[model samples]
Target: MHSNRRINVDPAKIHCYIRELDRSLLRLAKSSTSIKSLTFIDSELKRVEQCIVRAARESGNLVASRFGGILEISSKGSKTGKDLVTDVDRASQNLIANIMSETCPGHVLLGEEDPPDKKQEASDWMWIVDPIDGTTNYVNSSNIYAISIAALYKGETVAAAIWIPWPNDDGFELMHARKGHGTWIGDSKLHVHPENETGVPATGILSSFPRWMPKAFNINKQLMENQGEIRNGGSACYEQFMVAKGSMQYAITGVASTWDFAAGILLINEAGGKVMRLNSDGLFENFNGWAENYKPDPQTYERLRKWRGLILSGPPRTVDFVAANLSLKQPRLFTRIKMLFNN
Candidate 1:
């Protein structure tokens, strides 16, 4: 019975396991990369994916504990207004980190919810994870939630998987990717929908502003003028999946956490798309400096360590075009505190 059980969630540790998968895929693709046993790689990638789902399930359990069992939550303030952080996030991080370290001791782990204390840069083998990407949705019980995990052997995102436990009834959907190996959601290969007229179509092209950025408050205004459409699904993991799976052109917003976008971005990139700072607008299209820029509240750093908003995903031309237009008079206000204080 246990052997046939289908897993339904994603976990941080999956990033660690992907390192193993990438290694195996490298050899498999080479044909002669290895002359010995081959079943090992096949079995192992499956196992690695299982590890991701398992870890995500554990993370989900920890979150459920907070929602139903614990009320000891605190606010991260207006930046992440109504978003609450709990001991559960820390507890889950610790659990996932320990397991990953033990399994792939050589892999450097960078998590979204809990980043490394030491500021050393990510190296050849790094596991990037967002134990829970949509904390706000998780806390509000409004859906839009997931665990994101990715493997980056160097700065390049190598392989990734996003497992959502609930889709229709908060159930599950699994997406997987490996650099140069193509992307998959379940048994299907993935591709971003090419843009229509602009040659790119981003689903979240004009999602409502974060309620904080005054610069782009008129996103709807501009969308109407440009004759384009925008869509919002809820979670970064989901948005990225849609982009990779070719349902939407791309997804873009602001203020992304490394973990929140890690797995999804990797999936998009490995699938032959792009993700970069909205300011650059290089990933999808080109920036035109049309919309005023917006900065995430500095307090967001304290609320969640690794963040700068997320541009979920989409076709390169389409996304780049939007990013090119969005400009902020006060971009990253928090980072410029020293300059402000000096004045």
Candidate 2:
């Protein structure tokens, strides 16, 4: 983690959490329902967060052993070339779902590795679970990987968590967000950093493992040369978690999935940063949305417009400056989205 803010647990954590909840509700009034439902959502989320950490870490280590081995993988859609679903993915997602159901029977579960069951999609409150955010990484043991979970109510992410098993020089991170109560890393709650900007103060991107990609290749070369530091240990959930803590300026993954970033997008946003599509050039910003659709329409566009391959970062001026220097392409929706984003 690139952050200097150390965690010191006080009895006040609960009091502060409650006070913030009240204030957030008072401010929301009738504008949003996120306040009204967060209490129930937050409780269930805490349960999920606690139980998933060890399981997710174990799953990552379990999946990493057969490195460079042929994958027992298959494609999801008959016609789609890259939409793969694997045996490890199925087993892992099922493991998370089953554990969650046993631990939190009332909550719902939705995952990327399998077809949605009516039981999950129909529930009032649902948990979006990406058993393994980086499945390809699992196939090759290219990078360790992550498990992301976000609890949603009425299609808005009231609470979200991203867990990465292993951390680089930065240790493993756990990021949780509860509506307007703000974000947290382990026990330390985070605030909107009015001063810190992404990719500065330290290198923007933090890879859990260094050389996961390009072990010395082009993307790696450009990132190290331009971004400042490179680490690639394992796990997107932890990487994004560190960024939310301001331990890392940005968390980058060459390839990401709906589950990989869906919860992360919501998590970082709650922490006051943003996640956007990496280098997409589309008329509509890729919401990277799921069946959960746990965000407002505006939130989707904002996420994509802000993304540079799921960069968990903040400070618009700094992002633009970095994107420009990297020669990243602006989206077709960039012009329309700019007025809404720029003050």
On lDDT, the candidate that comes out on top is 1
TM-score of each: 0.63, 0.54
RMSD of 1: 16.6
lDDT of each: 0.57, 0.55
lDDT of model number 2: 0.55
Give Cα distance to truth, residue 76, candidate 2, Å.
4.2
Per-residue lDDT tens digits for candidate 2, residues 242-343, read 666655655444344445565766666777665554333321232323434434344443342233233434433334434443322344434433333321
Instruction: Pick out the ten consecutive residues of candidate 2 with the lowest summed lDDT.
Output: 279-288
Q: Any runs in candidate 2 off by more than 4 Å, and if so which?
A: 1-71, 75-85, 116-122, 167-174, 180-185, 188-239, 245-247, 251-257, 276-312, 315-317, 320-343
